[model samples]
Target: MRKTALYPGTFDPITNGHFDIIERALRLFDEVIIAVAISQDKKPMFSLDERIEMTKEAVKSLSNVTVVGFDNLTVELAKAHNASIIIRGLRAVSDFEYELQLGYLNNSLDDTIETVYLMPKLQNAFVSSSIVRNLLKFNGKTDHILPKEVQKIIGNMTSCTLH
Candidate 1:
């Protein structure tokens, strides 16, 4: 049976770090689904459509990878996608406790589904959606942290000059 993994995140703008995890996940699973969450807890800087478009553009070159959107329990979404594994990216020690709690909760909710954590390449490890969004908010450079396509889109979106 083909093993599918679900990598769920808000991916408000899809940073290069996210690309690192997705690429690495591909080597371990038959298919990796980039599940963009339509999160209710946090207000995203970019719309769901924007997040999906950015992710699609970033991952278009990858094979055995698909992108989709969801707004329900992650385990339920995984079941809907026929995925048995959940991919989580760990960037720092600070992320561990929270992620561990999530893992425990997810497992409790559905023991059939397993969660795996992968770390991004060191250079990209510090890059995150919130950081990228904050950089854009301050008109800071994001060329080094975001995918080229995403950088272009975010550049266009934030390039408003007050006359």
Candidate 2:
């Protein structure tokens, strides 16, 4: 049976660092689903549809990868998609505390669902969706920081408004 992993995140504006994790996850799993979360609480700069489109474009070159939007439990989403593993990205020691808490929570909710953490490349180690959004929001330069397709989408936007 194919081993599918669900990589869940807001992916508000998928960055190169995010791509790094997806590429690495592909090495360990037969399939990797970029599960975009419907995080209404986070009030993302981009709408869910926009985020999904950007994610699809950013990962278009990849095989055995898919993107979808969900507003539910991560484990439930995994079960629905037949994903036995959950993929998370750890960029620094600061990320460990949060990721560890999440792993415990997900484990408590469903121990069968395994969570695996991957680190981004050294250059992308510090890049994150929030940072990317902030950079664009303040009209800061972000050359090569985001995927080309995502950068185009952000550039085409009349305003990368924050809420």
For all candidates in order, the CA lDDT equals 0.92, 0.93
lDDT of 1 by residue, 12-45 (tens): 8899999999999999999999999998678888
List candidate 2 stretches off by more than 4 Å. 159-163
TM-score of 1: 0.95
lDDT of 1 at 39: 84
Best by TM-score: 2
Worst ten in a row by lDDT for model 1: 154-163
List the lowest-lDDT window of 10 residues for candidate 2: 154-163
Residue 93 of candidate 1: its Cα lDDT?
97
Model 2 residue 87 CA deviation (Å) reads 0.2
Cα lDDT of model 2 by residue, 13-50, tens digit:
89999999999999999999999999999989888999
Candidate 2 C-alpha error for residue 85, in Å: 0.3
